[model samples]
Target: MRYAVIILALLILVVGGFAPPVVADAGADTAAGLAAPAAQTAQLGQDDSAQTTIVVNVHSDTNATWKVRTRHSLRSSEDVRAFERLVDELQRGEANSSLDEGMFRNYAELAAESTGREMEIVDVSYNGTVTDDGTTGVLTMSFTWTNFAERTDDGGLRVGDAFTTPDGGTWFPWLAEGQQLVIETPESHEVQNSFSGIREGSVVATGPMDLREQPIYVVYEATPGPEPPDPLSLELVAGVGAMLLLVVAGVLYLRQQEETVPQSDTGPASGSVVDRSPDDLDGDDPDSGDSDGGDDVDLSLLSDEERVEYLLEQRGGRMRQADIVKQTGWSDAKVSQLLSAMADEERVNKLRIGRENLISLPNESHRTNGDE
Candidate 1:
């Protein structure tokens, strides 16, 4: 059974894609110039914080795909162009590669986009639309990417844009006050691993603004296919069935043996009379030598712990420890020691009230809080 359980656990690990953990350094340098001018950042901070919303939809198929939507409200017309410039600076990376694939793959497309005077985005499909109301500017952008998620060695899927440049710089939209981000995945998938900012039921993060930090990464496992039986569950079911079958077989065999065996003589044989002696009969004779009506039984052989346990069982399995000392005439120290011993053995439970310990048997569901 032990070997079977270990084997099943190994099979689960093979089929379940366990994601490895990661630790991020907050002080790590981020990509330079990703931040719009410090003045622009300050200017936006002076006003009411604008809301930035980002949503991601992950679809599982032969090639898993992600559709991301980023919506931002700008304070002025200048901010619209500023946002555009930032978007243009995003550049792209290699197709079918992960930000976590390695340090080299992390910046392949970023390096390519950085080389030339003209801005070019690679590895992902992206487009944007902007609208201005003469006071506030609204920019909405959508990005559809393949190869966004990589399958871990353990068969888990990892998704996110948490990447650093060759020079130890990070990539992400600058967070500002009151800005919130939400990433949604399918309910069928179980999110086994995530960063600190990723919450369950859907990843959501609110911020107080940091320009240099990257987004959180999410790793999850897709629902398994139905063809192969789950080894862990199969082992459990087989163990239970075997035990139940043994119990049923033993019962049937015992019944059959009892039916085939000869019957015992439960009554007196042929003509014999069962003698009844005088001591065997009960009567109120004067010289019976019954001390105290034979009611008192010596309990000196029982230990203090045994006596306490017996008292608790006789009184509906509960009593105050103080009362036990009164009834048994044991010292406070002796009662405390006996109750503690009984508690260790789980024969009785003890709870402290105002100044005394309450003792009761385990699993007394009808027991109430008040003292009797």
Candidate 2:
């Protein structure tokens, strides 16, 4: 009986060894199934522990400076090691690393393609650091994005098209959970309108919300520039004073000229009187007949100021005062006084260029150095 029992035990042991090992394989399969979800959960937890902040500074030229900061909580040694590895990779400029310039360029290209505008990312830089207490890791990246905002016709800025997809959908994949986006305008600008965002002074903050369903849009206008300088007031005062001086000088000159001219008596002088027919006096007046009778005979009927203005009109609304004197056969002082008076009245503009003054009608443009 003992021999039979021993033989049966041997046979059972042999059968068990030759079996397909199904139980061991089943246990390994169950363990792998259980570990996979745990690993996935751990990764998701790590991702949730990260906080991201993006700051965009919009400039008046439509360019933007972008700064992205990501903070990772180092809850375990594994997280610390992973963060350090990522920092090393980024420092080495490895492809597919965290926040590399190429990835940003790709995002910018995508934005440009969706918005149908030119976009360029430049001056990309990045840094990674651990907290002093070794409890957190921080990653920072910055760049300048050209044409990030659109300039409106009314001298304002329109933002938010870059975050949209080609099909009018939001690019929410760019935003992660616990992420914040802050947009700032130039110091000289103020937010005029915001579609959906929190406004704090010139800054607009968004996120920690559902950006996928609701995108952000903002419009800002440049503040009015500084008022005209005090020198302009001084210039007005000086101009009034100069005009008064010109008027006084003109009156004194007319008085001096009148005193110089011999007064006419009731009887004509022996040499000045001549036999003249009525036809000779046709279209002639005591004030208009004094010219030497050429093309200027018609101009003689005009007042001194009118004659100067007519000469300027003939020369296409702009003439040098010296040219006016040469055209009207007037003295320099007389043309200057007339132009000064016309300028004071805003009928003409006198621009001083070098050693000469250019006279133009108020509607005419001032002459540049290249002009004659």
Candidate 2 clash figure, as a count:
0
Clash totals, every prediction: 5, 0
Give the per-residue lDDT digits (tens) of candidate 1, residues 12-75: 2122111111213323333221111234333322234234455565555313333333344566
Candidate 2 residues lying further than 4 Å off, grouped into runs, are: 1-47, 173-177, 197-199, 230-232, 235-372
Error of 2 at 325 (Å): 66
Query: Per-residue alpha-carbon lDDT of model 2 for 1-372, expressed as tens digits?
Result: 322222222221122110111112422323222222223124323445667677888888999998877776777667667666666666677523324565456557667888889999998777778888878878777899999899888888888897665655554433434566788876678888875555666454444465555567788888999887798899999999999999999999998755333232212244544333342233344223233312333543566666556555544566666655555555677667778888898878888766877777665553333243
lDDT of 1: 0.47
- In model 2, the Cα lDDT at residue 44 comes to 20
Predicted model with the maximum lDDT: 2
| Candidate 2 whole-model C-alpha lDDT, 0 to 1 | 0.60
TM-score of each: 0.33, 0.49
lDDT of 2 at 327: 51
